[model samples]
Target: MDFVSELAVARYEKIGEIVGKCVEKIEKPRTFSDVIDTVVTDKYVGIPIFLSLMWAVFQFGYSISVPFSDAIDVFFAWCAGIASRIENPYLASFLSDGFFGGWGFVLVFLPPIAFVFIALTILEQTGYLPRAAFVVDRAMTRVGLQGKSFIPMLLGFGCNVPAIMATRTIDDEADRKITIMVNPLMSCSARLPVYVLFAGAFFKESAGAVITLMYVLGIILAAVMATLFRKFIFGGSPSPLLMELPPYEVPTIKSALMSSWLRIQIFLKKAATILFIGAVIMWFLATHPWDATNGGELIENSYASMIGHAVEPIISPLGLDWTAGVALVGGFLAKEIVIGTLAMIYGVGEEGVADVITQHFTPASALALMTITLIYVPCLATLGVVRQELGSWKWTGLVLAYELILAYIVALIVYAVASVVML
Candidate 1:
């Protein structure tokens, strides 16, 4: 430790010794939190326990959200039915199928999104998240990131824009930059819809496990990439893990709800703005050629399809079809738009979206697509922030180019490995 840190620790230890001597209990008993922490922060089992807890969170989210999703699907279908009976085909299609169908499909994922945030809030409120960070700090240090980076990386689970902003708390320039660069690999919640959709469709029996694996895969890739960055791009040793662990307390219901609501509000806002607009644009493209026959016909020959086809050969080796290509293109605006774009492209309402995805993607291809979505270039907002934070278009462009290349390479490897394993 540095001289300053060593002195600081010594002082805290001395104070702790005095406090222990000053406090006495009639009955010496460890608190419930202490017992839980003993196992939760254990060196041997902490990471596995943390991972298992996350798996359970996803499992709960999927199971509980399904009913709500169905309700949304039925409501949207009814709206489409009403639109179909309208005399003005253009206005009807625009309102019912274009606006509602496109955006509503994306909204169907709100339940699971909210559920994920709620679970996260509970963990944060209970003070387990910081412990999880502490548990993983050793592994992170080996990858050129200290425990401080874990907070920003965990924030990336909600969104990358704010997560990048959160890196400002790191005092060291190299640590902050490295943390920002790797933040995208944390599997933001926006990508959860994509994972849930594909996992439910292809790996139904183990959908939660599959989604958990996607998050775990993101962490692994982030660590590997951080190690590479440390070796090649930025030559610096990681800072020591130094942070205070807050006392575990029973989280109040109001606090958990407020936390979950705050995070989920971001998703709702994006669905209303970015995803909403992207849905309309996609719907128009899919319905274009300005012909009545094409309005409700197959989207295979539409302009969007052409764009996807143009990029097909580039991503085809990864087992992603034209639709997946187009979705990735739309993903540039926001990751959630990938789900909405697929909804528009398939012309399947939210209810049938999973079945359509199942028909189009095999287990190997689905895994590849999820990995690519997790690691590909940041969203438009995140990109702007990166440029702003780095103060150089040159560095921002480098970050973008490197991420795209890394995404493709990782995705292809995943496809190849998944294919072999499935065989």
Candidate 2:
């Protein structure tokens, strides 16, 4: 019940008891909100509407931002062209191939990321995410979680680092632990580029649908894991949800855009600091031994390639080669680096990355890739916060182990099923 409704009910109940049948009970006339909540919170349609709106959010985001992304891609390629003309070979390589090439690949994703953030901000500003929590609360209880836990998980859609931190609100240690353990299952916005690149390359017309499934998959897995943890480890029932839903209102464009900007600004700050350093290290590994590899001409001889090839046997069943291993390894530092790693290793620009990916990967493996990217270990920043919040390396290690094993099994299943279906 809303705050107003609670107050009204309290006043009337106390008065009625005092009056002792002197006044007949009243059936109040409904307001506009009463009518709207009837459908929006309906048992049958509520969850489906939630899913449909999520689909629309991505549809609006990825489709609407294509022009801006294309423009950014063109600009980066031009910058790389200029960077290539430097007098010194090593400096030229670092500037063009390393900086402009890799940075451009990652930056090409900004427009769609911005649009997705904007859409989520609008949903938040309009007060629907709380209603979404209400709709899913019954399902959450069955799976050993309070509906209120969904708030942090929803915030995880932006970044898991903060989302894990947000779990501080849960009073029960058991509840907080379970929520923290499963929160990484939410797909942070950093993984958007990987989804966009792979989905466009493989799923194409249904790219939006595929990306939506990634989000859905994360939510499902979080619930499933919460159930297992509750039954086996925690051994307690979920606390009942006791959250108040704020009344819905129209969000102003200025407010929505400003909030969205604040959300995406974190990425920009990290790109300049953590991401900048990681890119340099990756570049060195991918383009070293200027003598033997002929000044980074043959990436196959680079240290990164060697490491990737050593791990190839493990990932070969998923249809990814050494190159993908390299990218996945880089993703530990930051998810955004995954695309940049792929581009650098393949010697391709932002546009050519898709073409090259198609030649190298089929739809089945692409789906598997996307699935693993969704389910695999959280990024470095997220891991640090999880370690701190969990209070020890033991729990952190446990989370890592389960996620890796889960990601592998799920990706294997997806690969086998998609291969058969697509065949």
Model 1 residue-pair collision total: 0
lDDT per prediction? 0.86, 0.88
Question: Which residue pairs does candidate 2 place in steric collision?
Answer: none
lDDT of 2 by residue, 108-197 (tens): 888988999999999888888888999999998898888768888988988998899999888888888999999999999888889998
Please provide, for model 1 over 1-423, each residue's C-alpha lDDT reduced to its tens digit, 9 standing for 90 to 100: 899999999999999999899987587677877888899989889999998888877788888899998888799888887886788877877887687787677788889988888888898998899899989999999999978999999998888889989898888888888888888888888899899889888998998898988898888988998898888988989889888888898889899999899898888888888888878887787777647436757687788888899989999999889999999998998888887788778877667778788888899999999999988998898899888887789878888988899999999999999999998
Candidate 2 wrongly placed segments (more than 4 Å): 1-29
Model 2 deviation from the true structure expressed as Cα RMSD, one decimal place: 5.1
- Clashes per candidate (backbone, < 3 Å): 0, 0
- Return the TM-score for candidate 1, rounded to 2 decimals: 0.91
TM-score for every candidate vs. truth?
A: 0.91, 0.94
**Which residue pairs come into collision in candidate 1?**
none
